[model samples]
Target chain A: MLYEKKEAWSVLLRLYHWAFALSIVCLVVTGLYVHEPWTSTQLEAVRTFPMAYMRYLHFLAGFVFTAALMVRLYLLIFGNRQEKFWNAAPITPSNIVNFFKTILFYLYIGKKDHRLGHNALAFTIYVVVFLLAVCQIITGFYLLYPESVFWQGWGLKLFGTQQQARFLHHIFMWCFMLFAMIHVYLVVWNENVAPEGMISSIFSGDKFVEKS
Target chain B: MSRNLHLSDLNPTLDRRSFLKACTMAAAALGLSSEMVPQIVEAAASPQRPPVVWLHFQECTGCTEALLRASHPDIGRLILDIISLDYHETVMAAAGRQAETCLHDTITKYDGKFVCVVEGAIPTKDGGIYCKIGGRTALSILKEVAPKAAAIIAIGTCATYGGIQAAAPNPTGAVGVNSIIHDKPIVNISGCPPNPINFLGTVLHFLTFKRLPETDSLGRPLFAYGRKIHDHCERRAHFDEGRFVEKFGDEGHKKGYCLYKVGCKGPETYANCPAVRFNDVGVWPVSVGHGCVGCTEPNFWDTMTPFYERLPSVAIPGDRGVVSSAESAGKTILGVAAAAIGVHAAVGIGRRLGKGSSCCAKPAASTQASDDKSKE
Candidate 1:
């Protein structure tokens, strides 16, 4: 048997991945702090603005996350064939068959399968997470600027009230956290079980593959 | 002499100068200029005063009391000169059969020409028997009067969003006026006891414009309910500076710091309480060292409860009898996820060990094989 080293993720895709991950971490931490400030400053009120700083960081991270998502969306449309949305989350018959096979593999009932891009189930979850991120952005802007006529007319009408928007935003943060935990575990497991450099491929942009 | 009489003549308490001052003050409160004062005075002194039919149900009459305490023109002058209060159960000299006759006569005489002011929530459960006036259910009376009136003014949070009566476990199925009467244009003056200035401004806008004022999606006038209390709040600087009252009667409380930590819903409540104040005085809930209870928002009693806490506690549905804040819920879910991941990892390790050392060593062997093959 022969093996080959191949480019799996483009440089831009890897950049987007790390940027998105870092921003998500920053956003989650700052968002929780903004929601409920657990720390207080002993300095003069004029000298310190802990909550404001947390809120500022949260907003900054939110913008970064949005930018990262936009770049990823662009890659999904215009990147290499393997980075395309169809390859990542295709509903083709073969992909669908492999999705169930992958599930069975996870359940320890089937042989392990390797792929160059996201598995069908992982891609499906990514699509859902993408939608959640979009919701979070909309609700975030609504909370940030409640006086905006656009938000007042459209955001409020769609999301109900400010409190409702806040609730959705908070809930979506937890969803991201849940997804992150599982995502990390799955990738770690893949790195250990598969010949591919699953964990390092995201950072190094290359993976080992069996030669045809 | 009677035909040419002025507003001062009708109400002895108001003279020409003070009446002008009141009108000017009202113009300012309504976000109008001094030029609009004459129009306001004209509207107030109009010979054909717009008839108002006041109905109360499922409320404490605090809104009425707040209206009574309004002193820019005073309640006496407001009722006597500004608008013809033909039917109010609390202030009218008539009662029982006489009051009923007055209500019926006013509705008939001014049919489709008067403003119907609803001051409370209407109970709809079991035919709205919870509150009645003269053997007539409040629901029935509202349904009867609201159809004929030109417009409806839902006063107070009770009338705007069912208030406390419509809180969790609402037995009587209390609902706001807008929930019942959807045909007519409704202006919601929403608060525990809405500022009388907001009510007066709405009426003046209607009188000056010959229609109801522009309203938000919630049927609250945009002039008053357009901006959040936090935006116009006096202690907004403190909020920005991260100065908060940690508890009641703390040093921050005495120093008049922000009440964000003390469950002030001012950030969410869209009302001009901070700008307009209450009772013709320059003091609101926040100014007096208390948090805004978000009474102006819809379902405030339910959504903004546990008033001492910053965020509303998420209520678990069904009979689980568990109520937890969103933070706690998030933490709990995270904990469960962590535990599940831990158990899953442990089980995976255990299964690998059970399958003998070959399964565990397979990854390293495969990497070694791939490397050797690549070197071929």
Candidate 2:
């Protein structure tokens, strides 16, 4: 069978994807440690700085993730037609049907077909993940400065109290964790089964599609 | 204007020097410097003592009891010298029609000049019939008395946020003083029974300045309720070191570890309890072993319940079945992800094996055809 090399992602999209992934990984790891802080303290002389450092890392990654998301949204609005905002909306009848069809294919009940970009179900999940990311950014910043006058001025009053904001941020972190798990597993599975090199396409911006 | 005539003989222990010393101490408690001590003394020693009308409603009268129990300056000094305690149900000597007469007399006599100290939650349901004093409902009495007062001081958790009465399924529909009286400046000295120093500071601040001190968003005076209990707690080092008491009577608990795990609301609660200590014993709740119940926060009885649990269980919106604690919810999501990964791995191996067998047969057939073509 012959194969044709097609551009699957743009350079900016690929860069944003990797940067977002890295920042999310950093945030999740640092955020979890900051929440519970289960680490044993053998370093008694410098015990306070670990939690402080974890907080710093978590906040830095949060800002990075927020900036990447803003850039990704900007690209979605003005980038190629495939990456446009309209593609994110899966409201049409065929898109709805294809969403279920993709689910059925994943459950091994239908024939699989290679698509150019994100399939219907993946696109919908990506949209949800994006919204969750926005929530995480808001809640994370709210907790970061809970004691500041500005937070009490109008910030937390709009969202919630500091504890409630923390709860929401924790929930969003878990959502991102679950999303990453499912997303990575499916991407690897798609690359192995369909052999479109989906995982590499995120990095190289190209996928080998079957030439009919 | 005359200092000798102004000194009260009823309380012999409160002489001129002691009164001035108490004023200095009270001023210092109000976050004022020593320079303001003379002003406080002048305010207290003045012949025109501010009349304070103390109101009792749906409460156990713990606030009045706590105030009377304050030892640093003595309640006699606070009531007789600093301010005229006019009408308190618990402490007033008069009774029945005489007491009712006194309340009305004070209301009419002061008429927007006196301070109104409310000590309980006000019930608004069933025409506010849950609590009645002098044949009038608490709500009716508050509506009658609040507007005519110069300033309103909600002096307990009950008066601040409806306390335990305003918890889940409140039958009386109880609410704090601010809910009913919105026009007046209400200084909320909030706690189960707030530190008497906070009360003293507020009253003295008003007595000296002729105005209330700056308050927080919740109307708690910033001088006393400025910082969270956790910020200055004795076990803060334990919290920073992650040394938490996992259970009651455990080694960590005995060793004075942080009570964060066993539902210490100190991190979320704002109060000066850790700084002042109840009854001047150098011990607060956490110092003794129990965690803070967050009684200072609004609606804490409902919001900060399951007192032994780390975090409250969140109710998911639009879904009645999935009430989950934060820990359980996180575990459930992670468990589902792990199970999904396992299932996906099994399916992937099965699919790969099925494809392997079919592709093996095709490759064998192709080799035979290629061999035939080469031999020809």
Candidate 3:
């Protein structure tokens, strides 16, 4: 079947996606620094290297990610409804059955695509991932909300403590990782199974859909 | 500013010497009387006495013993005199059902006025069948008492996060008070049997401020469990100097060197025990020649084992040690994800290849057999 670009994503969307990728890298590296007990080399670098600067980078990235989320929510509400992000998260009985089929077919479990519908697996993963992303946003703010000096006093007025923020951050980190794992698996599966189909979607914003 | 204003407001008719002399005499009388002299003085000074109700469950009662054995001259009694400890299960005269009734009465009378002290874990296994008080599970009692209390203080490791009894395969399905009562503010005063002064200081801090004191990440009272024991330990000097006692009763140990090498969990433990020694005797685990067991930390039973062994890997959380590409941003996420996906895809493609080959071979075999059968 032939496919065309959906033009669902704006230029801003691409920028946000790339920027989010950049920040994820920063979070993981610095997060490691915070979690691991420091060695002598790390201690020396903490004093000497731009290690302290990385924390600022992480904060800046998080700030940008927060802004992207605000924009994303705005787009979701005000923009076109044809894109099917809502479709990615359908709840009808038929959609639920189809979702399972697509997920299974995509993973090469039961069948590839039984009449162009979702397998239960990927649908569940998509819903879980979206919810997890929402959690990521919640927990990310909980971390950033405490340290913010300007409106940060807002956190004191709101959630109460930085330690609570840290708790939320630590808890959601594992969730984010689990989501990332599943996300990469799906991306690779689509790429290998139908390489041309996978590359065009993000690069040119088109997807593999059957001929109507 | 308020203190200065209050001092200036006092009448100038009384001389300083007479005033001072009167204070000393009153202090002496209060010390000797064993009555409500201190409480009377405090009551007259302030309008009301803060009431505290302490309850025990699934504990060694070491915390109570520690509380009673205060540092100086029995401040526990002084504390009682100051704050009306109207109901205490361990130390009160009442017993069994009557004691339970006293707790209920205090809860009813004070309502949201009294502070609640819990010392032990709440069992949740089999609908909390493991522990029973007055024919009801501890979980039920906690659900009943905790919500109504003004402030709940979980006063030991057991009460804070189900210390030992809640370890793996936990028979009781033990949980902390906070785990159950998410609405009320809980102050965790955790230790195996936390230093009594820590407890006193927390209560005093509350009395002084009319609010709970600052706490650490684990909801621990910061003033008591802020710094690591290893940070200010006496043998810390020896550890810094790289002089360690390798074995118990070894030459280095005999010299009173650092006990870190022999499995001291002090580095990870956070408490004020080193500064404020136990038993008011200037002695603690390390002082008497034993290593720290890290009893205060969460999952200590799992994370801190070989009570004598050192941690194997103490690397920073995400500093991927010798990976091909180690970018300091976002942790080691992409590589781990990429590797996992790569392996999954590799196996998937390999299976697809095998499937294609087998399919083709089977078709060729069937066709050849048909041809041979026709010739025969």
Task: Give the worst 10-residue stretch by lDDT in candidate 2 chain A.
Answer: A40-49
lDDT for predicted candidate 2 compared with the true structure: 0.76
> Which candidate ranks first by lDDT, i.e. highest?
1
Q: Per model, how many backbone clashes are there?
A: 0, 0, 27
Better of 1 and 3 by DockQ: 1
In the range A109-197, model 1's lDDT, one tens digit per residue, is: 98876687788878888899989888887898788667679877766877989999999899999999999999999998877777688
Candidates ranked, most accurate by TM-score first: 2, 1, 3
Model 1: clashing residue pairs? none
RMSD of model 3, in Å?
23.1
**Would you estimate the TM-scores of all the predictions?**
0.53, 0.53, 0.47
Per-model CA lDDT versus the true structure: 0.78, 0.76, 0.62
Report the Cα lDDT for residue A43, model 2: 34
Q: Which stretches of candidate 1 lie over 4 Å from their true place?
A: A1-212, B1-11, B71-76, B312-376
What DockQ does each prediction reach against the true complex? 0.04, 0.03, 0.02
Per-prediction TM-score, chain B alone: 0.78, 0.78, 0.70
Report the C-alpha lDDT of model 3 over A1-212, residue by residue, as the tens digit.
67532333333334445555566666666666655536535454311323434444555455545544444444343222321244344576766767767756765785554222223455466456556556555555555433347535654454456666566666666776777777778768767875445444445444455445
Ranking by DockQ: 1, 2, 3
